[model samples]
Target: MAKHARPGRIDPTWPDLPDGEHPVSELAAATQGSLSPFGDVEFPLDDVPYVHPVTEINR
Candidate 1:
């Protein structure tokens, strides 16, 4: 028998819809040129502590 799917649940066989209607797709499009966790987009480079070159490290 086929299993029923519902909101807040995951289904392995979900079909891909057009970008306009897909939740993740729409989010990606919205942040296409900006920094977003869901994307590999980079932020405007200026000065960020964590990203700075490692100057000192203990052995």
Candidate 2:
């Protein structure tokens, strides 16, 4: 099975989608800008550069 489920349909809210390419910044926004995978807190996108790759890479 695919480790990460690709969105069946791109979300319009994500202007970064549909084009089928996402930059590092756009990927973070798609996750609602979660800083940590721990689920306790979220960091603002502007405040945080990008969600750490290890956390999202396998998601």
Candidate 3:
């Protein structure tokens, strides 16, 4: 069994995901500045930064 973080709280210093979970930030970074195909039109995909809730509240 793996340990899970408590609800409504996340550690920005060590953000760990449960099994089979992938970070959205990783996906965003991987496709950063790429184009998304959208039915005869392509849209630019911008890299959106992910800010933790704690950090956001502190700001």
Candidates' TM-scores? 0.24, 0.16, 0.21
Stretches of model 3 off by over 4 angstroms after superposition: 1-12, 28-59
Q: Model 3, range 1-59, lDDT digits (tens) per residue? A: 98886866865666588987775544644455544444334335465456666644554
The full ranking of all candidates by TM-score, starting with the best, is 1, 3, 2
- Alpha-carbon local distance difference test for all models: 0.61, 0.56, 0.56
Worst window of 10 by summed lDDT in candidate 1: 30-39
- Give the winner by TM-score: 1
> Total clashes, candidate 1?
0
Q: Give me the overall lDDT of model 2.
A: 0.56
User: lDDT score, residue 15, model 3?
Assistant: 53
Which of 1 and 3 is ahead in TM-score? Answer: 1
Q: Mind giving the per-residue lDDT tens digits that candidate 2 earns over 1-59?
A: 65675677666575554576775554656456435655645445347555565644664
Worst 10 residues of 2 by lDDT: 37-46
